[model samples]
Target: MTVFIMVADVFTGAHVWQETAPRLAAAGSEVHAVQLTGVDAGRPATSASIDLETHIADVIAAIDTVDTASDREIVLVGHGYGIHPVLGAADRRPQRIARVVYLDCGMPQNGVPALATVPDQALRAQLAEWAQRGECEGELVPPARDEWQRWGSTAGISDAALDRLTALAAPQPLGTLLQPLRLTGSVVVVPTTGMLCTRNGVSIDLVQRLVDLGDPMLTALADSQVTFFELPTGHWPMLSCPAGLADALLRAAAGEGRSLRPVGAGVPPAHLRPFPLDVPELPRDRREHVDLYVPDAEGPRPAVVFVHGGPVPAGTRPTPRNWPTLVGYARLAAAEGMVGVTLDHRLHDIADYERAAVDVAAAVELARADPRVDADRVALWFFSGGGLLTADWLTKPPAWLRCLAASYPILAPLPGWGLTGSRFRPARAVAHAGALPVVLLRAGRETPEIAATVEAFVTTAKDCGAHLELVDVPNGHHGFETLDPPEEIRPALHHAMRSVVTHLTS
Candidate 1:
C-alpha cells in the first residue's frame, strides 16, 4: 500500500511529517509528500491569482509522479490547509485513492471556501483584516508565523526543529484561502477518517456539538462514512504524536473497530424481513433506494412511511443508505404489527423542495402499491428537516394517509436556506389540513430555533382546528432517539415510539 501525505504547507508539512512518514515507510508502506506550487524556498512567491485549483493540480501531479503504474492502493492524508487541496485531488482521482485521513483539521464542503470554513470567527476576522491590508498594498497576504505558533502544536518538536520550521515557512497564497471548493459529491465514496488532537480537550463530543450547531464542514464529515480517532496531543499531531498518529492511520485504513457486517446491519428480531425497494428512475449513484420492513403475518398490514431528516445541503452526499434511528422505528412499527417502509428521498437545497417532494410522493406511492401494505391505512412519519417537506401533504392530505408523526421537525425555512413565496411552510400548511390526526414529538433540550419552530407549529395548528397530540420528552435533545440517551430517558423514547406506532396502527 502507498500513503500520499499532503503536508499542510511548505514549512509545516516539512516539520510535521519528518517523523511520521518514516514510521509509515518502516511499516512497509510507500510514502510520498506533496509539494504545492510556489511553496519551496527557491520558488518565487505566488500572487493573488494562485488559488486552490492550482494547489489541487500540484497534488495531482505529485500523485502522478510518485505512482507511475497507479496499481497500488493509495491512502490520502492531509493536514491543516493541505486538507483542502487533497480533498480536491481526491475528487479528481477518487478511483486511485483507498482512504482519506484528516489530521487535526476542519473538513471542507463543496461551495465553502477555505477562509469561510475556518471554525474560529475571531481568526476569520483577523484574516479578513490581513486581506484588506494586502489589497491596499496590491500584494498577497503574507503568512502569519506568530498566529501559526499560537494555534499549532509545539509539544513534541525539539527547539532546533521549531527554528527550522520557522525559517522554512513561506507566505501562503491568499487566493487559495478565498476560493470555494467545488465537488460533485462523488468524493464521499472514499472512506474518511479523522485523527483528532485532544490536547485542547477537543473530543468526539465537541465534534457532535459542532454538528448540532450546523457547522457545515463538521456536518458534512459526520454525514459521510467517517471514523474518528482521538490523539492526546496538540493540533499538529504528526509533529507532536507521530508514532501514535501513524498507528491510528494504519488501523483506520484496516477498518479496525468498524462493524464487520455491511452498513445498515443489526436489525432487531422485531423486523420480520427487510428488503430494498428499487426505483429504476433514480440513478444508483443517487442512492435513492428504500427498505421495506414487513411483519411476519401473511395478509396486508397497516404501514408507516419513515422519512429521515436532512434535506442535507445540495452537493453533499449522505454515506449511509439507511439511518439506524429510522430503521429502529421501522422495527418498532413491525413489532406493533404494522408494516414499516423506510425510503430514501432526494435531499436538495430549499430551492429544490418541489423535486424532493416528488421523491417523497414516489416513496408513498411505492409503499401503498406494495401487496404487503394496507394502502387505505398508511401513515407518514417525518423526522427533523424532512418535516419541512410535509407541508403540501399535511395541508391537503390524501384520503389514504391516516395520520402524520413528526419528531423534532423543522416546520419553517431554516435560517440560511429560506425561499420567498414557498408553499413549504408547516404553520400555513396546518391551517388548511384535513381531518387527519398528527402526533408531534418535542425534545426538551432542542436548540432554541428548532424549539421555536415546533412551538409555532403547535400553536398555529391548534388555532386552525387541526387535531394534534403532543408527546413531550422532557430530558431529550434534538436527536434523543438516536443519540442513545441515558436510561432515564429510555422510557420517554419508548413512549414516543409507541405513540407513533399506536397512531399508525389505529
Candidate 2:
C-alpha cells in the first residue's frame, strides 16, 4: 500500500512527515508526507503570502514526486484542514489516487465549503480568529512542544515519540484555511470522535451529540464509493494512539471494511430484531399497497410509524439500517412487555404525495384502531423528506403518538429546503408543530439545504412549547447513515425513544 499522509494546519514539513512516513513504509506501505508551503516553519515558503491555490499546488507537487505507476495503490490521508489541499489535489489527479482517507475530517461531496458549516456564529468567529493567526512561516507551526506533548500522551502517545516530534515540526500557512474545495471524487473520512471539549470541562451530552452526528458522514461517503472506518479515539490519535492509528491505516490500505478486534473477540453487542410485515391495500383509486414491520410479541405493544424521505409516489420503505435501531427499541419494549410497530403508508400513488400529511394522519388512525397496539404510547420516527409528513401528522395526531423523533428531518418547503422543489411542499410540516415532545437530530456535515431544513424544524418547534432537544452529531449525512452504523450512533436514538416512552408513560 502506498500511503501518503497529509498533515493538518500548523503541523507540516519533513519532520512530521519523516516520523509518520517511515513508520508506514516499514509497515509495508510506500509512504510520503505532503509539506504545504505558506505556513512559515523555520523558513519562508515564497515570501508571497500563500493562499488556497498555493496550498493546492503544494499537495499536487508532493503527489507528482511519487511513482504512482508502481504496483502499489496510492492511499491519500488528510487530517482536519489538510482535507482542503488533499481534495484539491485529488480533483486535479484523481486517477492516480486510489483511496483518499480523511483523518478526523468529514468527507465533503462534489461542491462544499471548507469552513465548518456550523450555525453557531461565535464558534465560527473563534475559528476565523484561529485561522488568521494559526500560520506564520512557509512551514506549518505546531502548538508549543509542551502542549503537543500533553495532547499526545493523553491520546496514548509515547514520551520518547513526543520528543522526536518536537524536533521535526514546522509552521503551516494560514491562507489555505479559507479555501473552498471542489471534490471531484469521493473521500473516506475517519472523524475525530468524542466530546465537545469547551474551554470549560467536558460537556458529556454535547460530546455524545457531536460523535453521533459526525460518525454518520463517514457512512454517507462510503455509500458514495468512499469507504470509512469508525475508530474510537480523540483528535490526533496518531500521537496519542500511534500503534492503533497505524494499524487502522494499514488495515484500511488492506481494504478491511470493519474494525478488527484484538485476540479475544468479546461477545457481540446486543442487536435489534423484528418480524417483517406486509399490509395490503384496503382501498385506493388504483391498486396500491403497503408493508409494515410489527414487533413480535404475545400481546399488544406501542407502535412507531416511520415516514421515509422523498415523494410518497416515488415509493419508500423503512431501510435495514434503521430496522436494527427500531428492533433494539422493540426488544427493549418487549422486555418491558410493550409492543413496537413500523408502518408503511401510501405515497406510491401520485395523488397521495400532496396529501401525505392526511395520508399519514389516516395511518395513525389505522395504527390506533389496530387492536394489537397500545394507542397511548405510539410515536413518530420521521426521516428526511418523510419529516414533512411526520411534522404534518403531528398537527392533529391520533390520541396516541406521545413523541416525535426526526432523523435528519425536513421541516419546511422553504427555498433550498428539500421538499420545496418536490411534488409536495414541505411547509405542511411546519403548520403542525405543537403536537408532541419532539427530538430533532441534524447531521453536522449535511448539505446546506438539509441542515437548513432540520434547523427550520427545530427553531419552529422550539417556539411552540414542544419539549425539544436538538443534537448536532458530527459525520452524519442527509439520511443519517452516511457510513456503516457504529455502536456509538445506535444508543442515541435508543435513548431518545426511551426518553419519549418515559415522558409519556410517566
Candidate 3:
C-alpha cells in the first residue's frame, strides 16, 4: 500500500487537509495530514518564536509514525509553506520516502537565503495585504474571510468552511518564513513529480515558473523522469475539486502518467509536433531577431512568452544545464496544444534594462494578438534579469496581457554576488504596486547573504495587498543550474511551476 503524508500551508492547520485525506484513503492509499510545531490540528491556533528547526523536528516526528513496510514506499506531499518542513523531514530520512511531491511548492537550494529569488513587484503587494490584518511582532496576520477569497480561490468549499478558514487562520511564525532550508542527500533520486491545477481563479502563472525551473535542477539525470501534470482547477484543489485532485494523487502514487483529464472530462489538448516559428525581429533599430516557437495546429491555446536574462544578449534557449526545468513545461504546454514562444531579449550591454522590458512587453502584445494564442490567458515567464524586466513591464504593461510568471527575477538595484555593474535593491522596488498573484521561490543553500533582502521584500509584499506564495528550496542555487543537484531540486521546481500555472490558466 502507498502512504500519503499531507502538509498544510502557513497559518492553516492540519484541518486544511481534512477535506483531502479521505479521498486518497478511499483510493487505496493511506493519507496522513501533519500539523507542524505549535499549530493545533483541530482548532485554530498560532505560535511565536517557532523556527525552521522546530518545524523540521515536527515533520520528522510525524514521519516516524509510519510503520516500516519493506514492500511499499511512502509518498509525502507538502503544500505551500509546508514544503520547507517536509523537505527537512526527507533529508533526515531520505530512505523512507518513496517519492516526494511539493503540491504547488518547491524545495530550496543550499546557501541561498529565504524566498527572495521571486520578484519584488508581486511580493510587495502580498506583504502589504498581510500587514493590514495587523502585525504581531513583525509578521503579518493571516487574511480575513473576504481577504482570503480575494487573494485565493474558494470554489467548492461551503460558506461555513470558508468562514472557518478565515476565522482560524493566524499569523505564521515569522522566523519560519525567513528560514532557509538545507538538504543533506540526493532527495531527487526518489521519484519526484509536480502537479499544477491550471483552472481559472488560481495561481497558474507561479506554478508554470517552477515547472520550467525544474529543467536545470534535474539536469544531472540522463532521462527526464520527473512528472509534470496540469489540472484545470484552482490552487486549493483539495478544497475546490477534491475528486479530481484525489485522482492526481493516485496516479502519482502509482507512478503513472497524469495526462488524463478530470474524471470523465475529455483528454487535454492533443499533442502537436514541436513546430519552430520563424525568428522575429525586434521593433525599432535593434539588431536582434529572437528565436521563436509557436504551435502550428491551434485556435487560441494558452500562450506563454519567455524572457531570458542579460540585456545586451538574450539568454540562450534552455540547455539541460541551465534550463532543464523548462523542458517538461514546454512539452506539456505544447501537448496541451498551447502556443509556446521563447525569445531572446537584448542583454545588459545591448540595451538598457528598461528598453529590454519594453521589448518583452511588445512580445506579450504580439502573443496576445496571435490567432493560435489565447489573448485572455497570455503569461510572461522570466528568470533573474528576465524577472527584473518582466516586473518592469508589469509596472506599466499594455492592456492586453493577463498574468505573469517571473522566476527568481532581480527586483532590487544592488549588485548580486560576484556580478558587478548589476544593481538590486529590495526596498525601492515595491514603492508602488497593485493586485498581482505571485509565487516566489528562493534557495537557502546558494545565496544566504541575500536572505535578508528576500525577507524584506516578502515582509513588504505582505504589507501590501497581493496574492503571494513564498517557497524555500534546499540545496538550490542562484539560478538552480548546478550539476548533480541533490535530486529534490527539480521536483520542487516542477511543484512551484505547477502552482503558478494553475493560478494563471485557471
Best by lDDT: 1
Cα-based TM-score, every candidate: 0.48, 0.44, 0.51
Candidates in order: C-alpha RMSD to true structure = 12.9, 13.6, 16.6
TM-score of 2: 0.44
What local lDDT does model 1 show for residue 154? Answer: 45
Query: In candidate 1, which residue ranges exceed 4 Å CA deviation?
Result: 9-11, 42-48, 66-70, 126-149, 153-158, 208-224, 257-506
| Model 1 agreement with the true structure over 1-506: per-residue lDDT tens digits | 65655557423434457677888889877877766666654334465367788878877876666654756677788876788888999898888778888877666879877765443344555556755565322223333544444444445556665566667676666667776789987788998887766553345644653354333544555544777787876666666678998888788777552221222335321112232221112111111466777777778998888887764533333322354566667766776777777776666433556777888898888878878888988888888878888898888998888888888888876432324357878867888786788888888887555676788898999898898888888877766664533564556656766766666666
Candidate 3, residues 1-506, lDDT tens digits: the string is 88888877766877777767888887777877877666654422354566666777777877788887556578888776677787778878888988777675534676432333222224433544443443313454676675553333344567777788777776666656555677876675677767765432212333333333233443332224555555665456667777777888888877764331221133211111121221222211111333234545546677756666543222323322123333334444454445556554555332256566566666666666656667877666666545455445435434444455655555543221112233333333443445555566766653322344556667877787545576667666555533225365666656665665675577
How does model 3 fare in lDDT?
Answer: 0.56
Weakest 10 consecutive residues, lDDT, candidate 1? 278-287
**lDDT of residue 118 for candidate 3:** 22
lDDT, candidate 2, 17-81, per-residue tens:
44456577788777666656645353356655776677778778877887766776767677656
Q: Candidate 2, after superposition: displacement of residue 427 in Å?
A: 35
Task: TM-score winner between 2 and 3, please give it.
Answer: 3
Prediction-by-prediction clash tally: 0, 36, 87
Stretches of candidate 3 exceeding 4 Å from the true structure: 41-48, 69-72, 117-138, 149-158, 200-215, 218-224, 258-315, 318-506
